[model samples]
Target: MSLNFHTMHDKNPDIVASLARLHEHHFGARPTVITGLQGDGSDRQIFRLSSDANEPVIGIYGPNRRENEAFISFSRALHQHAIPVPIIYTYDADAHIYLESDLGDVTLLEWSNQHDDSSSVLTMYRQVISWLPKVQLTSKDSIDYTKCHPFAAFRREAMQFDLDYFQSSFLSRFLRIRLDNAALANDFNLLIAHLLRAPFDAFMYRDFQSKNIMICNEQPFFIDYQSGRKGALQYDVASLLFDANVNLSHSFREAMLEFYIRETMRYIPIQEKKFLTFYYDFALLRMLQALAAFSFLVFQKGKSYFMKSIPNALQNIAFLLTQDDCMLRRLPELRRLFEEDVLNNPQALS
Candidate 1:
């Protein structure tokens, strides 16, 4: 019985054998229950494997070897810097199976849903914001850039990838909006240039939204940072405040942005005016990136539930397109597609 793997015998026997051995090696006994846990947007399988004697640990079965390497490497480095990330206990590289301390499942998104007080929620977000600079400035040098998945830094090509992703996934493929190709490409270049103007010396948590945050013991612990790389600080800040899930009001967003600037200035030299100028530019980029992701999930993966977020994302895009400093003004053809075609006709997106 000690060697017998529980629950996972049917899902993937090959992985179960390796995971069972790893579990037994660490806990000295077979897990009593290997309960399946939820996953994010990745193709990773997770479980809670535990027995009566030992505290439960999160079991992971990752299909992507490079992503696994990035997560494990960053986890170790972040842990060393006293960051509040989950600790990696053990892993079987060949099997793509690993174990880490479980932090429970209360995400900042869930926590926000449960708590409604403006002041309290603001304080909570402030706390989350306060840690971003520390995560960026402190543990950044310790992070092995080579371990970053796909790319080691947020470069022009990466930004273009997300833009092209949105265009392919939602605009051209789904909506079939006839945008001015030359103008669209011009606008993309302008946006990319504006984003890269900021200091790019910090760890950019590529998806720093609420759902990626875990509320453990009333403290914030970050996860899903395997996609992170060296990039401008404004992008992550924009990601958090402008998160589609919470959809913090503009006033609150402004207050939180101010708080972030203050927190960031404590550790690094932040030109407030310069940071604000580039903030919304990155915000637009983040929203479009998210829209691209949601669209891909719905259309390609057939996750129909993601379709619900499209309208809100489109609304955010519509707002950004109207701003004077937004790149949309510089790209009228793309702006017309959003204004007259996609955003104006919601049915086009569906």
Candidate 2:
């Protein structure tokens, strides 16, 4: 999964020269700097290219060519539907290099952190909520799900992927917690069946969170939507509200859920009561997936910032665990293991 991008290493003269050539060919001038940007969990290498003559552009070098293609194709579809995404100026499929409009450095997460006022935060969150339904409902007929990376739908198989990711990456690798594999599998099956029963009619922004949202001129522009797929409506909302890094307040989360329900009704008819009922189910599942990712990144990958999020993720899981209506409660063995391995042993996580 090696990337073919340039950075500030003096030893790699060839890499640097190649990047300069790319900048000159694209923007008519060699970039003054091709600074590498910090990455999350993905294997992709992102660089910010800037020059005196040309406006700033982002040059992305991803190892997986298919994922890059997914982003380019999906972004174009979103742009066509008037959704805000970084405009893909050019992409080289053979090299897996992508050059796109630079949406600037401010993410919704960073922007929200700068403001302490609760009302202001809510206002920003509300704006984000308003646009989600549009992303899910708009261009419903036109999107080619085949272009979605990995899969087209968040179906049972896709749900299983997250479950398996948690089991192998977190439970086994990070926590070193052995489990009754059969029991856990049974529980996973039940949970998947329940989620599959939810309304699966909209385009789910698989990773709809504050960090992936860029604030360009105070307006939200979506990025990193390569994982977009057809899935249950509640999953996206859950991802937004229960985001580990953001950790939005409980009251605000409730308000946003209602806002999403109301906003979504504008585009399609939904049973508010039913949607509300299934929201927590999705939220709980999303929390599991997120924690699994956090565990892998923090523990296995040795990325320390993700460790700070463990407490928040655990807190969210604890809250869900206490709820009598929780679908996860049905799996007693899994519950006991999680309670002992994760919830009860908070000292180790810290």
Candidate 3:
């Protein structure tokens, strides 16, 4: 059966059709329907295809050329190194479509949301950390830090998001206040400088939050991990622990970090004190980036979900800012910005 490429809401039909053809050619039967799944920070779309009762399921991804190529290559490389990513069945590079074995139904986000006690959730997350050292060891030679954008680039992206969305929409349109405050801009610049100067580098998952991880067969399975690149080693750790969506407590996060350190030591030797420094610096950077993201989503994307999480994002940033000496120096300005724009502004708080 043929499917229209444009009729589907958020996917490229041409890619979908190509994937259908590829599946039919390989499996000798077409999928019943391509059901859309939640997406991440890219223009890619994911779909699951269910086959006959006796046959296994197939996972299809429609990513752009660069991302699609990287995922296909990375999956193969990681698979060779015993990482638990989805097994790729076939890839049609010309059409930007690839098929992989379905891991299972439950995502870490869904699993965590369902359980009242977070112990089981943390256990599974610890398993994920166990896998990271292997990921680091295997991909060490393959990971290209030069290809990965640096903290400086991230700061630029955040500023663009702020200027285009938060400053233009919220400060000007919503609050009727022109964003001509030089002092506020300077404070933001200082914060950006602090982030860029922070130290650390390793394979970064770019987006290693709960939602991107799946719990298949009671194990933490990673997804939306195609953006993995050379970055601060602690970036993923900070992303997972200080996640605005999951809201894990400080005590739990610290324990988890300790757990990660112990497990990572099994494969590689890392100094406890030096690793902690990276962890703190990366945490501060991640928090700042998230602050920019929350602001962008609310003011530019008109997303109310992100708006609700703004306070939590700010709190995380404040917590991290207080921990580091470099960030501590800029705490007064940061507090001023938060109070004036976030806390005191009742409308934004809402």
Candidate 4:
């Protein structure tokens, strides 16, 4: 789990040197050392490279070639839209090195956890949503999805997030569950199919959540946004509001969702009824996605940090399933599994 940038630099000394030189050229001081190693879900190693005279620290990322290009392209697109993401100073596509602005250490999650009152936190979160439409519409026209790895190309990789990993590896193997119901298995497969086919035409911050968002100088700044893509807008909203990691209350989640809908209307031409429907559908899809992810964390990764969230995750899933009879009927076994196994036997689910 420990990220070693020194080792990464050793593998690509030339690229590292080029980054250091770029940092010096941009900031008028050579970087002191690379720091910070707690980033998740990325093969890239993020580092805060220091400079003299209170210079803005530079972020260096070591990733594969395609992601490097996407990061560069996406960063430029966001910048053009006046979105508060980091500014890229330099990039070496071949070496997969990215030199960019450092937004500092105080993430939205850290700020919310530190304060007693979340009123200010909520305000900043709303501001982030205010900026979302600009990011979505502007970025939609700027970046080319064909330039990066396509979602269709990731079909096999996406399946890793489905029952194959969750049930076979995590549940059956790690949780030691001897699942008796074949119907439950069928429903789970159906749910996965439905999600994989969900419309993905908008520019999406694939990992939009509190942790990747920073509150610097009282303004919300986006970080770890390189995984952004052309995906459902509701997917990003669900990622933020229903975030299991930060654990915001239901009241606050509702308030934020309302804010998003109202604000999104100002930019997009969608009707209120259609938008509301999409919101509920996306919420259900996201909750089911989280359930699968939580299952993986507990059963495969052995991360107990997600155990407490399972009940709430199942509750959200249940709430969403109730919205659509087709979804409910199609995934009836999943509904039963949630009620009988998850809702009733919280201890077992945990």
Candidate 5:
């Protein structure tokens, strides 16, 4: 499971020379500064490259060629639809290097933290909600699904992958919970069926959380959407609304989910009752997916910073489980296991 990308020091000759060439070609002058940016949990390398005369630009060295290609292609498609994604300036596929427009350092999470007032945060969220439909619905028919990484759409197999990962990585390895594979598979089937009931002919931003949202020029610009594909609209909504670390209030989630519904109505017709039912189910499924991912990055990828979210993810799961009438309440064995670990151990999801 080695990610196929090489990491280099800032002064590494090959990296500097390659980025210098891209900067020289795109900016008409060699970059005078090549400052490395703070890295993320992933293996990708990022830098801010610029000259005194030109605006700063981002330089990326991705580990997986296919993932890079998926992102580059998706960026081009979304930009054509006037989405505020970074414009790809130039790239060298062989070198795994690409340059993009610099969207300064502010993320929506950071922005929200700066504005402590709930009203201000709500306003910013409304602004972001305004764009969610455009990203999910408007560009659905225009983009090529073939270029989507891993899967062209969120299907049964994709849903199963999350459950399987949760069992193997999170439940067994982290929580050390012995699971009944046959019984859990039945619950998995019900979960997948519940999720697929929603209309899914829209673009799904696979990682639409606050961290991927860049607040530039007083507006939100989306990034890290190389994982986009056709899927249920509720999935991305669930991702943002129940994001593990954010801890949005119950009232805020209610208001925002309503705001989202209104905005989404402008694009497509949806039944309120059915959508809400599916939304909560998707939220549960999303929490499981988050736990799976956080554990994967921490254990398999060796990105220990990912552990920061495990507690909140477990909290979200606990809150979701409190609904006595939800889909998860039907799966007794699996539900018991989650409750045992989460309730017994306050931190680290036990």
Candidate 6:
């Protein structure tokens, strides 16, 4: 006798099918195809769903539901404040799929890269920087920090996270060098303590760089701001100026800093000297965090794209190391390790 067995159907929901459904609901029909866009550090998968009926919309499929929630909530809050973030259209809370306005393919970095004119590039940068103070200071009282991803503020814990992350991902994994951990810890504590005292009340765009700012319709629009939270005002500016991938010139960076200070004064009272002092300290911290992320991507995760950024990140660190008045000079062992194991080693170019 011949016997046949019946197969059981799977219960798990199809995310692509859900996304298609969402497209249909929004666009009157499902898109012909969903093309994926290149992503940054996050694990979120982004798709551009397009059809003839309407403009294309961006579909975001993120693994972490809470992270997606944070972004959606934050985007709503920012939009409510009249900030230039992409307008989020719909969200399927259960499926962790969300749709938002497609801000086009060009980032500020891409736009700047196409131009050979320094004046035009600097103007573009100034335009973008002008929007920052609005994000930081405008509608200042309404934001709910609890909606911020991972944490509410860049407090001591946050600083320590960057320092420890650098130690693990760069110092230990990439360089394969041993250092005086106790001494480094003391230095870390000092740096954190110093940074913690900077103006921590502003909305810091934790990773504010050219790549995160999109250029659409000849205007600057911000993106990738899910990591934003309460932190020192100087950190975001530092991140943009010291961005390893962008490799902004020292003189250009200083010019932008001065412009930022002048713009900042219009919104709030600021002592230029004090802000500059804190700015250098924050710049050092941002460089360390960036190096950690680059090393983590290149060495630990085997992503070669980040390898190109290593030299510039190290150069920024070297520049900071030379600053006689910077807090980084106090950390002798940390300085020595970066100099000997990282700067001196030709293998770092790999």
Candidate that would win on lDDT = 5
- Candidate 1 residue runs with Cα over 4 Å from true position: 2-10, 348-350
Give per-residue CA lDDT, model 1, range 1-350, as digits (tens).
64434455336766666676798898787777677766767788788887777898888899998999998998898888888999998988988999999999899999999897888898899889999999898989989999998989988989999999988887876677766778788888887887777778998889999889999999999999989999989899889877877767878888988899999889988888877777778888888889888878877877777787777777778778777866666666667777778877756445
4 or 6, greater by lDDT: 6
TM-scores for the candidates: 0.94, 0.93, 0.80, 0.79, 0.94, 0.93
Candidate 2 lDDT over 76-184, as tens digits, reads: 8889998888999887777667789999999999999998998988888888889999999996666788888798899988899999998887778777787899989
Model 3 TM: 0.80
The whole-model C-alpha lDDT of candidate 5 against the native structure comes to 0.84
Q: For model 2, what is the C-alpha lDDT against the true structure? A: 0.82
**Runs in model 2 lying further than 4 Å from the true structure:** 1-7, 10-16
In order, the Cα lDDT scores of the candidates are: 0.83, 0.82, 0.65, 0.66, 0.84, 0.82
Q: What is the lDDT of residue 214 in candidate 2?
A: 92
Evaluated at residue 264, the lDDT of candidate 6 is 84
Candidate with better lDDT, 3 vs 4: 4
Q: Write one digit per residue (lDDT tens) for candidate 3, span 1-350.
A: 64323336866666667777788877888876677666544456677775553255555665466676666766777777778887888888777777887877787777888988777777777888788766766675665443343222243554344434544444555556544467656766665555555343455567788777878888777776666665456677778888877778888898999988888778777888876745665565566566556665656666657776666766776576556543534546445655566556666556
**For residues 146-236, what per-residue lDDT tens digits would candidate 5 score against the true structure?**
9888888888988898888888888888777767888888898988888887788999998999999999988999999888888998889
Error of 5 at 171 (Å): 0.7
lDDT (Cα) of model 1 = 0.83
Candidate 6 lDDT, tens digit per residue, 23-135? 78876876775666777776777777777678888888888887787778778878988889989999998888999999999998899999899999999999999888888
| TM-score for candidate 4, residues paired by index | 0.79
